[model samples]
Target: MKVTRLLGSGVELADGSRIAAGTVIWTGGMRASALTEQGSGQRDPLGRLHVALDLSVTGAAHVYAAGDVTLAATDDHGNHAMMACQHAIDMGRYAGHNVAADLLGLPTMPYQQPFYVTCLDLGGAGAVYTEGWHREVKLTGADPARSVVA
Candidate 1:
């Protein structure tokens, strides 16, 4: 469970053990971008900075986080924001809008996206269009949904 040395040829463990290997790959959980640490706020286990419904960093009025740097609510039902591209774009818009409003002394709107959708290409099987968090298929292959995407 412990690695004392790791060289291109092999690895050495703390117990004076050596194992020859071709390559070593390290896989671990995701962490938020280092930029998230610029603000003083809480973070989730994934290291994503916590934010309010408005996407403002908790306890940091001048700090706002969006996209993958933040842990934001995705809907009123309490789903957390995802790191996917669609969710990132959604959060980015809210963060920008709220920041502008704060600068202009205007009311800020709460960020919420109750619906989610995805379109995936299945190669020879064509593509599929799915809706909602459950990923219910609404269209497949050459269906009109595919046309809509086109």
Candidate 2:
């Protein structure tokens, strides 16, 4: 597959085709460009580089966040998991129904996604279908699956 990793404006290929200075156009697969913040126009905000994000999964579990304060927890309940869409859907349902019940003194709906499936859009490259809370991650490539549907 033809891929172009553009780390910088300067193009250099360790192997494969390399474009010339006067080349009209160039193309390649772009993964992650340098993490430059918007407006700042630099990888770091100020002259002092803050460095990488310290992800402490253990500490994250004990601390709970709501609304826009969601963070990643690595090992909550023996499975370090994402605060993802699945969790969002569950949270929405629970929060909405609970609020409604509280207002009218009715029974609040319990929120639990104990048994469910996951569809991960791997950036249109492909997707992974998994059982449980990310227990198994499988890529559906060209073949997709072994058995043909009847």
Candidate 3:
């Protein structure tokens, strides 16, 4: 199925056709907690807390968050962190390092994850290992080259 445009309660197609949608299930990413709303921290469209370069909450500098809970810019183009382990691992390291640095009166490490990768489990269809933000599947299926190297 191909989608062209979106209507109020329906959608328009490239063939100049309109289809009324009864339900729209957005397959976006994960959803973050609403705890940020209780604080002075700002949240993004996904409800993830807006964070500074040091992974600290924007308004609440004393609080630092990582993983899917924070909406830290991953790139200069304003790409925020995606809800994936690839980002969480790195973000956790940076968050911890920065917090320690702050206590030690040293410079904090800025959060930056320029690389994006995904390993999707396709079930009966096997799996795929993707690379980069575009998520180009570099290795797929039962191919021998698909083995993940440490």
Top candidate, metric lDDT? 1
Judge candidate 2 against the unseen true structure and give its global Cα lDDT, from 0 to 1: 0.38
RMSD of each: 6.4, 12.0, 8.3
Task: Determine which window of 10 residues in candidate 1 has minimal summed lDDT.
Answer: 141-150
Q: Candidate 3 on 9-115: residue-level lDDT in tens?
A: 88777887888996555564678887767987778778899888889888785678999888888878767788888788899999999888888889987899888
> Mind giving the per-residue lDDT tens digits that candidate 2 earns over 63-131?
112221223222334432233566545555555555666567686543344554566444336555666
Q: Which clashing pairs does model 3 show?
A: none
Alpha-carbon lDDT, every model: 0.82, 0.38, 0.80
Instruction: Tell me model 1's lDDT, rounded to 2 decimals.
Output: 0.82
Clashes of each: 0, 4, 0
Superposition-based RMSD of candidate 2 using all C-alpha atoms, in angstroms: 12.0
- Using all chains and alpha carbons, the TM-scores for the candidates as numbered come to 0.71, 0.38, 0.72
